[model samples]
Target: SELSEIHSALKEIEELESDNAGAEAPKNLAGAIKVQVDRVIRAYRTLLGMSGHAQEVLEVGENPDEEWKNVWLLLRRDLQKSMPRGSELEKAWHEAFNVDAEVAFEAALEVRDLAALMLVGVRYPFAPAALRATKASADLAFAEGQRALAAKGYSALMALEPFQSVSRQDLALAAIKGYLCTRELGWRKAEGEFKSWIDANPAAAVLWGEERKPIGALLLDFEKAIPSFDTLELQLGESLVSMPMATLAGQPSKAEPKNLETQAWPSLKIKGPLSPRTSYAMKNLLEVEVSPVIPTVTPTSILVNTGEALYGFDFLSGKSLWGDGVRLEAPRDAFHYSEQDPNLILTAARWQDLVIAPLENPLSKSTDAPKAKSSFGGSVFSHFPVVRRALVGVDQASGNILWTLGGQYRLRSDQASLPDLEKRIAVTSFFTLTVVDDVIYALGTTRENESQLHLVAIDPAQGKPMWSVLLGAGQGESNMFGNPMRDAMPGIPVVAEGVLYVQSNLGAVMAVEIASQRVLWVSRYEALPRPFTRIRSTAYRKVTHANGAPILTRDKKGNLLLIVAPTDSRFITAFDAESGEVRWRTQTENAQ
Candidate 1:
């Protein structure tokens, strides 16, 4: 029956090839035939070992009734003679099959090998089928370890083309799983490959698109996958690439980094329905040297800074109740001022230095001055008395300065001349001051130097330094000037529960025990490894408001608002304070 089937298959192949003589025949047919004959020969050899003479008779080329041995030898010789001398069939048989079968099968395959290929396909259809079957079996093995098996299956499928839609779907799923499971195989590579394949087969978009959504979602699951700076770069690059020809007609071909930087740091425009109108001004103009203090008290009074003195106004009615416009001699351009209490204002007067003026009566009119100067102990009343820097303080009536403080401290000149003065004190310049309780903080740089930051605690009552901490070592006057002003520290020191929270410009956040002058805890901000230029170039603005407790805002690289809680384990939280809490989270971004 097997012999008859082989004969029938041979006839069918012969007729098919004959009909396709004008067309290209299947290319691998000869190799396929050799594979089949090799298997049959092995089986015969095994059978001969089991049944001796009987198998030998069956193996002969001729009938047993007609000298089968001679006939068999003759048939084998003829087959060998018919084979092509130098072909793939000859090489395959030689490498893969036994020597005897190699010679015989090579001969048989070369003779248009219909019988051999068909016989092999029928008997051991399993050679290639087994490979396909093993692949399915391996996929099932994933039941034990889904990720590992899925990865292996994906690799295998990626090397071959799928014959069916189901097969393609399976392969795609495996690829997605593999990408998700292996960190070594990053999402970028996987996405790239997927995209490339989709591009090659545009029609597969429907199938691939369905798969892409999940893969994309999986990629997004990795919090640190795509950096914000990189995203920005891509966005900018795309925008540039997509620019209309008309738009670029007169412009330069390339955009400079400076141009991008300038465009990026635009001053925020306060506009919209919620924005305060420009015509709106607090009533009762009072001049204080410091930034205004907004009191939390009902019918709150906001203290305003007038050129020389401090004044308080009722926030509701915007009415100024009282102000002492006392013209005291302040440091040259003595804008250095602050209000400790709505009634008590501290101003750094020009030549005489510091002065603390106290208003005698509230809601009382008349240019009557108090009888004696309120004693903060020292004749010098302002915490900052440096010649070039302003002063900061809180007004007597409102306690709003608890969060915001500003003043400048200048190093005075020994010589009468301005140039000589700049040389003597190394002229460190501080333009802003912050006072917490009795401690006063100054943020500024020296003349012809980098910005300098100094934390000085003073007896507000006596105008004396309790303690002073210099942020950086001063690189004094140089013939060739460098920016002596270092970056301002990330956030101001939050003084709460007798402890101070300080964040360094270098991203180091430290908690200091004020009394002991000891660092309680230290934490570093999560930032990309980049040069300080990228960091310093970013915009930062401090935000202050009472949220559960007093929360201080420090912009991290101009992209994130770090809301640091000084009293609560020094927890530095984040929120999109400008847009509300909707998009409050920290994400990494590449630095340009």
Candidate 2:
């Protein structure tokens, strides 16, 4: 019955296409097709809700109804041709995902209705690999001989595979595909390490299925080619276990014994002092009430956000400019930035000559969150849920609120729209914000869903977004590897030569072409979930977690290299920007 209804809907769409046959047909068909596609998507959703879509996904064998399969194929062909971009359905999908529908469809293993939902929206909080069958896409890319795509795809998939949403079956399949791709590409995935992986994971045996024989025939070794834990020497700090980095289509790294201390260091060419001393001491300008924030410095002055107010200071003299500071109502707590003190790095942009800064302004404080038992313990309030923040433009000369964007920023609500859902959607906390040619680029997660990161370009003067793209790993993913008491580390984005390079603390680096917002590649260094390093605060009685940032550098060969020390504590990894492949990783966690 549902199949007949879906056909009727498609027939209506076809008839409308035919009826409006002319140069003006597409213009006329836009509204009608929207309605019909809406019908088609709803019907499929209802059908999937009733059947084998147990994990909120319908795969090849999940529902093998031949008639339904044909119905979907017909619907998919039509929708692929006529489904208009920028529709409400697409907006909803984009609201929750970064990749377009087709890529998501391929990731979902060619589920026709999945494609429809791409034009439509997924019910989010997905159980799939970052909201799609990214593993399947990588496998196809490898089969098609697209090494770069396959490498990056597998890189991203492996990093995200550890999340709770990904099933063990899917993870095992990913590993098997990884083994095959490595073998085909001649990349250095020693059979020994793979066998070790299977040995450690007996579950992979059950899913090995047909691939078992071929993989078995290949030279097998019980010992790993890469050095095992016995060869690992723990520094006094971290014990981040590592995994095979074969997904990048790069050569396996040769073991370098810890001779780093004996190696000669490069000269910095500084003629004079190697270390600098503080030039000025300016205190009492403002009290460290609720933790501290790294101030925004300009050529003439600095803008300081104390979580309760905006303070202006004379850069030349480091003296307070405003008395009592321009106190902000419902100021956000700053304790969440770090465990012991404030995270000293935050960005501030200039719009219409006003300082644009992200400040947390809470709605209501929750009692369930951990409170500080020590001094200025009120700062601990910012660490809890139900916090709202905004990008505020402040008058540099007078410390006046000029304009505020996103969420119901109470300071100047009239300048920004207020929505009940604003708590989750607004551009709240960003790791990096930069203004290039008058357009502001921001990368951060939402207050509600820290893992759902968004990269947005904004018109600072108008306080509106020009366009926004979701980055990776969204829909409320868990920070399984991060410090249990803290949120996942947000990746700091570095833009160069029109490409944006970002890394998830989960151990993957991604490059996006800025002009088209296309994700060029991802290189992953997925490691087994281990306890992250954290520091306990004696003053605040709270534990501080490890935080690392990435930077862009060029080698002597003039090639771009992305270097980052993920909180994983294994090694500081470097990736080739052009190919998204691992260039090198330090032998030890603290080395270099």
Model 2: how far is 406 from its true place, Å? 2.8
lDDT string for model 2 (1-592, tens) is 7778778887886677566545344443556665776587667766865895523434445533322333443344455444344333333333333444445455455553323332212222122423355555565665655554455455545545333245656555555556544543334444334445545665443234355533333324212233122122223234343233211111122232343222221211111111121111111122232443444444345555543345666534456666555533542432222222233234455544566666554443343233433334322222323233466667767777766655442324553565533433454554456554467776655534345556778777766766666666544432222212333334545655567777665566778877787778978875434443332322211111123236577675446788876655477778898899888888565465
Error of 2 at 19 (Å): 82
User: Each model's TM-score?
Assistant: 0.27, 0.41
Query: Each model's C-alpha lDDT?
Result: 0.34, 0.48
Worst 10 residues of 1 by lDDT: 245-254
- Clashing residue pairs in all predictions, respectively, total 48, 1
Q: Candidate 1 lDDT, tens digit per residue, 331-384?
A: 332222112212211212100112222111111112111122234542211121
Candidate 1 local Cα displacement, residue 340, angstroms? 27
Top candidate, metric TM-score: 2
